[model samples]
Target: MMRSGPTPDAGDLPFELPRTTPRERARASALARALASAYPDAHCELAYSSPHELLVATILSAQATDVGVNKATPALFARFPTPAAYARATPGEIEPYIKSIGLYRNKAKAIHAAMKDIVERFDGRVPGTMHDLLTLRGVARKTANVVLGNAFGVHVGFVVDTHVQRLATRFGLVAPGASITMIERRLMALFPREEWCILSHRLIWHGRRACKARGAGCADHPVCREFGSACELRISAPSRATGGAPARAKPAALKRSAPRRS
Candidate 1:
């Protein structure tokens, strides 16, 4: 899947990006603008008071909802206000507060280990750089991008969560069947560097509110019509696979004036 795609530039470093046409990039810009106007105040939904708290919440957010994470974090953050505090407690000590979240045991372990790493390796401060952030337990490119962009104001890369991944293709911003890695690069190539963080926020809001994966009724929404006609064309849109890339529905599925309702 990682066919050498121009060794991605510094804008999207650490991964490869398939070459894009100027027209495609323009469409992406238009989409970003539409989302900006539609969701002017979009932001990271995860609640946190500090960089280390954000890092811990993000780790707990894997395969979990922000609502669930937020519900758990208030008490947890109040209890262990700093990485040094978390470092002193065992994972078991952190579990009760987060027990409401899915996979609480594992998340507690990851949070404890990551905090210990920060205290020992990074001097009790959350590492701001992507490379250093990834060294933490339970961190990957997505979590690293989240912490870097939101916590540190360093937009080195785009965050490719479920919403971003789905909305990217539904808006026709990337090639059909593109991998998540590829979708992220295509987005990087298309949008301005500074827009990466807030753009993700707005797009995620759109996905959740209008262009939902199930029972969506926004086919005629102005933004969807102008930027994401594919969102309405569910028959031809990408399946909810790993990358959220469209599957290119069979020709038989395209013979319709109105999309079939779910």
Candidate 2:
């Protein structure tokens, strides 16, 4: 039987040595490969034609769906075609375009403030570096990562949104309640640096399509079978084991049978 250990704190390392085993690394590789194959065309779902547009859309995406942001940005981007244009406008002018989205007032203020910074500090261009991007209002690591990866093709870190966080825990990549910083660090250590940008996208796509928060459709997904033996959905088990009969196991037995990562 696999030994059970104390659940790690939110920011604590999964192990005392701060390292992953060969088995864990192999599983991570397989998981990444599976996700990449499942979502070969995975890209940022936000609709934008420029880095500035992507940045603004990303800012508006907080607590809002990508489709919702897409619906709002067409008119918003048309009016404020550039950072200078947004910088010239008041928050009141921007609010109407995005009022359909949640927290529109705050987002308008942030967009106005961020555009002003871009005009003043970045010479009417979106800053490419993570540090500079963070200086803008309402821009956090996730938004900076979206801009850096999709906009600039730079891979500084993994994007750990709600989908990524939920999927990572489901796959046993990190302990439950791990902070986003810890999750990003764990993912960076697991996958190659070049794969970091698209990795999040693929995971998000999978989370949205198959591995939903409420229920996972793992039975039809072979990649999940390869790397997700511990999934709550129990997809790894054969529908019929012996004598063409459905396999049945007790709840206690199933819990004990779950894989434990080192």
Candidate 3:
């Protein structure tokens, strides 16, 4: 049986505690390998050529799909190709390009303001460090992590978006209702620092293509087949023909326990 103890609430723990046991680390490593093989070309779906473009795209991606962002960015980038151009343009001018995306007004305002900051403070270059990147409008930890990882190849932290959160929970890497920060901490502990960035992409790919939120396609996926039974949310295999839940089977006796707080 898995070990147990009187663990404190997740809120009580430090935001970043790299403290996974040997078995958990091994499991995480294996999961990463399987995902890498399954999705060989998994990468940041946002299309961008420069760091500035990526920063803008990441900001726009908030509460929006990457496909949506990509659809909007071609014209948006054409109009405001450089940080100085974005800084100079008014939000009203920017809004027309990204209007199809959700919260375009607010995102345009943030993009305008962030570019102005880049122009004035960083001399038109997108800041590479998390500290400097966080100062920009609408640039949260998730956005910063995206830019740092993909644009600059810096693995300061992992990106924990909705997909990452759901997949991590489904993989039994974290408990249900765990905060994004706690989930990120658990992932950081489980995987090596270098794999942090790409790991998020792989999880996202799996989440989007297979382990969907409403009806997960978990029947034949290697990682899901191996790990699905222990999922905190109890992901069920879906029927191939109907895309509905398969008929229930007798529950297997629990073997590996759900992850416990250390």
lDDT score for residue 37 of model 3 = 90
What TM value does model 3 have? Answer: 0.82
**Each candidate's lDDT (Cα)?**
0.74, 0.74, 0.76
C-alpha root-mean-square deviation, each candidate = 6.0, 9.5, 9.3
Per-residue CA lDDT of model 1 for 1-262, tens digit only, reads 3221222345446554455444545556777778888999999999998899899998888878888889989999999999999999999999999998888999899999999999999999999999999899878889899999998999878898876766665666654557777778767766777888999889888877787654246677778777555334332454333133333422211122232111
On residues 49-145, what C-alpha lDDT tens digit does candidate 3 reach at each position?
9999999999888888899999999999999999999988999999999999999999999999999999999989999998999998778888999
Give the Å shift of residue 97 in candidate 1.
Answer: 0.3
Residue 198 lDDT in candidate 2:
91
Q: Write the per-residue lDDT of candidate 2 for residues 1-262, one digit (tens) a residue.
A: 2222222232233333234444555667888888888999999999999999999999999888898899999999999999999999999999999999999999999999999999999999999998899999878889999999999998777898878876776676765556788678767766776888999999988877776655445535776555453345222222211111112321111132222110
C-alpha lDDT (0 to 100) for residue 203 of candidate 2: 92
Superposed on all Cα atoms, model 2 deviates from the true structure by an RMSD in Å of 9.5
Which ranges of candidate 3 are over 4 A from the true structure? 1-16, 229-262
Each candidate structure's TM-score, on Cα atoms with residue i matched to residue i, is 0.84, 0.80, 0.82
| Clashing pairs for predicted structure model 2, backbone only | none
